[model samples]
Target: MKKNNSPFGIGGNKSTVSRREFLSKSFKATMATGIAMSGFPTILPASVFGKNAPSNRINIAAIGAGRISRGHDMPGVWQYDYAQLMAVCDLDSLRAEDGKKLINDYYTKRDGKPFDGVKAYTDYRELLQSKDIDAVLISTPDHTHAIIGVAAARAGKHIYMQKPASLTIKEGRIISDVVQKSGVKFQIGSQQRSSEQFRYAAELVRNGRIGELKTVYVGLPGDPSGGKKEEMPIPKNLNYDMWLAGTPEVYYTEERVHPQVGYGRPGWLRCEQFGAGMITGWGAHHIDSAHWGMGMERSGPVEVWCDKVDFATGGLWDVHGIFTTAAVYANGVKMIVSNEFQNGIKFEGTGGWIFVSRGDYQATSSDPTKPGPQAKKLDASNPKILQSVIGIKEFHFEISKEHHGNWLEAIRDNKSPIAPVEEAHRACSACLVHHIAMKLKRKLYWDPKKEEFKNDDEANKMLSRPQRNGYQVK
Candidate 1:
C-alpha cells in the first residue's frame, strides 16, 4: 500500500509514504502471493484423505428490500451457490413480500423443492439478530446504510452494503473504523471495481500503460435539489416513520416515497432526504471507477472548486442540476465531476488519453505510435489485462454477477472483499467533497489527515449532519 503522509493518515498517524506508495507496495504483495499460489499443484491434503470439502453456504439476511435490492442484489445473491437467502426485511411490507416470493420461486424452479424457512420482517434489527443468518445485505436508502451495516457488523455478521456507503463523510469514516474493529467481512455495493472492464481500466492506469495519469474526468447525472412538490398521504403498506430512520422527518410525498416504474412522475432522486442527489447515487459508482483507475482509493482531492449554474425549469435531473464541481488532487490530478457532461470517465496520462463509459472504450489519439497497440501491450502479466486480452465479454449483468460471486468467495475464504469498506469510504468521501464545494460555492482547501477543511469552520461542519434522536449511527 502507498504510504500516507497526510496529517490525518490511517490510524490517525502521519506517515512518510505517500498514498500511491502504500498502494504500490500492497499491489506488489498481492501480486507476489497470488501469482505464486497460481503455480502450486492442485493436491488434496492427507489429513482429509479423499473427502471433498464441505460446502460453506453463507445464510444471508437482506435488509431494506427496496427496488434496487429486488432488481439487483436479490437475484445476484439467489443465483450464487455460496449463499442462500434466509430472510428479507423492509419497511414496506409489500416490497418485503415481493422479495420473499421471488427468492422462493427461484429456489423452487432451480432445485425442484419447496423453499421454506425464509422469514420476513419489518424491523432490520430483528433480522440481524437471527442466529441463522451469517451475513447481511443492506440495500436501504443512503441514510440508513451505515446504521444497518454497523449493526450487522456488531452482531458478528458480514455485510454487503450499497453505495454510497454512508450519507456523510464522518459516517463513512466511522463505518470504516467500525468494520476494522469488528474484523468482519464488509463489501460495498460498488461492484464496478470487480467488473472486468473497470478492473482492466484501472490496471492499465496502474501498470503505466496509460503513463502516469494526470487527469480524470467523470460525468455524473446531477445532485438532488429537493425540488418543489406537494405532500401526499403515506402509502398503506409502507411504514413512513420507519422509512425516515436516521433522516430529518418530512411530510410524506408520493414522488419521494415510491419509485416511478413507467411514465407519469419522477422518482426519489429529486429529494435530498433519501439520497445524496446524483453525486452519491450514480456518481458513487462512476467516481469510484475513476478513483480506482487513478490509484487514489485511499485518499481524495486536497481542494475542490464549484461552478454553479441555474437549472432550467421542468427538466429531468442531471449531475450538474444542483451545481458543477471540479476537484484537484495534491498529486496534480484534476477531476471534473458534473452532470453537465456526457456520462463517462476519461483518463489523461503522459503518453495518451483513454475514455471509458458504460458503452465504449477508446483513445483520444488514434496514432499507432502515440497510444495504439503499444498501450495495450503495457501489462502482459496483470490479471486484469490478461482477462481483457483473453476476450472476457463485458455486460452490466455479467459484471454484477462476477462482483456478487467475488463477495461470496471472499466470505468463504475469510478474505477482504473486492471493494472493501475502507476503499469505498474514501471514494464516497471524494463525492462528499464535491457536495461541500457546491454548497459553499468556493474553492476550499482540505486537510485529509484531520478529515476536515483547512481553516473553514463552516465547511468542516458539513462533514456530518445531526442524526434523529433514536437513529444515531454508532
Candidate 2:
C-alpha cells in the first residue's frame, strides 16, 4: 500500500525504504566523522552530554510544533541527557521553521557550542523518513493521533504521543493492534501515571489501603465557552488543508486552527472535528488515573450513561460542552466522570478515601492505623498521608518521576514505557464512550473485551467516523 503524501523534496513517489538500510548508512556517516580518532562516534545527542555523561543517546523529532511543543514537549526533551531533538514537523511552515530556531538556540546556549542545521518539515511523513530520529513526540490533535501513531509504529520509531490515542473508540483499537504487533516502546502523555501523588493513590487503592475500592470520581475541566467564531481566509504561512489532514475539509478560521498572533492554545481543541472537547482533552489524564487506581487499566466499564450533554451555544466548534457520564464496570464499581470539579481523580473506598490532582493530594482514614486517606469533614492538613510509604510485597507501580525521560530510557532498553499503547487505548476508549452516550442520551452496555455495544448496532456504528478522501489509515 502507498504511504501518505510526502514533502516537496520527496514528491509523490512512494518508494519502499528498508529501515536497516537507512540506519546502517546513517550510522556509517556519523562514525566516519569521529572526533580524535577514538573509533567511538563523537556525534552524540545532547541527551547524553549533560550531568549524566557516557550514555547512548537516542535521536528524536517533534511531529506537532505548536504551543505544547514550545511550552512542554520540546523543552521536556532537553531535560534528559539521553534524548536528542533532530527535527520538527508542523502543517504551518512558519511555526515549523520557528520551532527549529527555538530548539537549536536552546542547545547552543546550554552546551556552549553552536548546534546548527536543525531540520524542519511541513509534512510529518518526510520527518519520519529520517533514520537519524530514533523516536518521535506526537502532540497533534485527537483526530490525527491514531493515523500518525500507527504510521510511526510501522516505521519502527518509538512514540511518546499525547493522550486519547483516538478520536473514536474503533480507531483506538486500530492503534492498539499496530503498536502491539510492532512491539515498539510507547508512552501515552497521560503524565499522571508518572507523578508521585497520582501513582501513590493508585498504589493505595490497588493495595487495598482504601479497603475495597467501590467508587471513583474523575473530575475533568469543562469545554471552552465562547461565541461563534467567524470564518476567515487562511493565513499565507499556515497550511489549513494540511492541518485538517484526517478530518473533513472545512472553511479556514483563526479560531479553528490556532490564534493568528502568538503560540497560544489552538482553537481546534474545542471543535468536534479535531477534538472530543475537554472530556478527552483533560479526561485522558484524570480518567486514566481513575482507571489505574481502580485496577481497571486493562479493562473498562461495562455500561455507561451520560446526561446534560451540551455543545457551545453558537460556534463552528460542535463538541460536547457540558456533561456528566456514569459507568459501571464488571466488578460492580461505579465511575463518575463530570466537568463539575477541577482536573483530578477521587477514589472512595469503604475504609478510606483519597483525592489527588497535580501538585497535591488529600487523604482521610477511618482506621487510625493507616495515615494515607482523606477525611470527609476535615481539610488535608496532616502530612502523614502524603508521606506514607508502601511496604514490601505491597503493590508498587513503576517509579517514573519524569514522563519523557522514562520513554527515552525505555527506548534505549527496548522495553515498554510506563504508559504503553494498550493501556492508553483502553483509557481513551472509556472517555470516548461518554461521547457515544451523550449523543444517544441513553444508557449503553459496552463489552470491553469484545469492544462493542451489546446488541446496539446504532451505537456501535458511532464507534468510528468517516474518513476524508486521501487520508484513510488503510
Q: Highest TM-score, which number?
A: 2
CA lDDT of 474 in candidate 1?
76
Instruction: For candidate 1, write residues 353-471 as lDDT tens digits.
Output: 66656553321121012122222212232344334431223111112236677677666555456678888898888888888887788999987667889999999999998989889
Q: What is the C-alpha local distance difference test score of candidate 1?
A: 0.70
lDDT, candidate 2, 173-283, per-residue tens: 999899889877788988777777777778777877667888888776565666347778788987777678778888887878877667766678888888788778878
Each prediction's TM-score against the native? 0.78, 0.84
Per-model C-alpha lDDT, please? Answer: 0.70, 0.76
On lDDT, the leading prediction is: 2
Q: Where does candidate 1 have its weakest 10-residue lDDT segment?
A: 362-371
